[model samples]
Target: MTDPPKAWDAELVGKWLERRLAAARHDQAAADRRGYEARDDYDKAAAEEWVCRALQSPDCTREQAALARRIKELIGQDDYRATGIYDDIRFERHVRGHLRKLAKMTKANEGFEKTLRYQ
Candidate 1:
């Protein structure tokens, strides 16, 4: 049997990667202008802010911010070998669990905010 045709051509893939790299570089430059010492610092700060918003909370607690940073770190490592997971599937599942936890926390925080508003 003949092998199937490839879904993506090399040129197309290269162009896609180039666009992504360019966007990443632009973001890095903006972060530098904003006084972030490193790209990771900028990413962590953004993640912390996202986490706080997802939780519907006014501010991120130290632990919540840490969790957000951890999530970012885990995300950059695409495989189990780097993240200590047994397999890729497990790694994705782990990340999904963390996301679910964030959602739940957000719901609880929203309720708390509502309670405060009512009182």
Candidate 2:
């Protein structure tokens, strides 16, 4: 016979998820700031060199090469802000959606556990 399912504390799970979300947000913000600062200090020759290096790398993805080309274009136009980077908002939304799904699963499991205990 199969063993019974384990019980989980919904409150504890919620708290853990919240902490993870906060950490992810903080990390994303730090990365965005770093990227912006790096772009500010970047030059056309540096961008071109990076693109050349990327093109030479066998492991570089098409998306990465495309991004490198875009960076070179931005450098030529003197438009650092148009780098088309920073997916923090999208990442946060995905994390929140995943957390919500986990919360729902936890709630369902808690209800099942309560039913099992009472029986």
- What TM-score fits each model? 0.28, 0.32
lDDT of 2: 0.36
Q: Write the per-residue lDDT of candidate 2 for residues 50-69, one digit (tens) a residue.
A: 23332332332123334334
Candidate 1 lDDT over residue span 86-108, tens digit each:
23454354445545554454333
lDDT of each: 0.39, 0.36
Residue runs of model 2 more than 4 Å from their true location after superposition: 36-119
lDDT of 2 at 54: 27
**Cα RMSD (angstroms) for every candidate in the order listed:** 19.1, 19.0
